[model samples]
Target: METTRRAGAEIALTEMPDDGARGDVDAATQIAAYRIVQEALSNAVRHAPRAPITVSVIADAADVTIRVRNAQATAVAGVPGGHGLRGMTERAHLLGGSLEAGADPDGGWTVTARLPRHPAPEASEGTL
Candidate 1:
């Protein structure tokens, strides 16, 4: 996947099971969920070179979740800010989803995102 992306410079790669939708997931939601994983992988590569990146997507009757983890990045010299993490969070929020990013106790950093099966409108229907 990385090699293919590198070849195109601007292309992004996504991997998912071929079993079709687990439940009620729509096309838009699935695309957004994959984008979250793609962005997370890009960030891990760009910010923590040489670190191993793991991406996983799981779907069930209720939601789709994406997880990306990488080893801790050693502090680099003279680097600027990183908006990849922030941008990912914003994307999740915009889709009425949630994102979690933090260091793992065993070592390394991890990001897990969950986007509900239903769209925002349907999800918010009964909220007070």
Candidate 2:
């Protein structure tokens, strides 16, 4: 959050359960969620410095969904690659989740990652 703010962009966070409260989530899931936000903010800060960015997290009984979006910036150049996306994707995947990062056809970029409440067996400590 501070990352994008420091870069001159306004950042807002929204949670599904409402009131912005983080309720009953596991450590690994929480860490993965934080990392996803961190990486998304890093990308916006570096590429769309003055754009508006929103981070939304939705959690239900079975899964947690996160979406980060930066407003369209006509001034930003041809776009950047990598930008911690690979690490973010790996984090999501390790948590029995999936991630998608892409530029919006109209403008800007969006990153979405979803993690399951009960992660799969393959997402073990050694696998990470």
The number of the candidate with the highest TM-score is 2
| Candidate 1, superposed: residue stretches over 4 Å from native | 3-20, 73-75, 122-128
Candidate 1, residue 21: lDDT:
62
lDDT of 1 by residue, 12-104 (tens): 223466347664676557666766777776666666666666677777666778888876666355666577778777666766888999888
The lowest-lDDT stretch of 10 consecutive residues in candidate 1 is 4-13
Q: Estimate each model's TM-score.
A: 0.71, 0.83
Highest lDDT among the candidates is held by which one? 2
lDDT of 2: 0.80
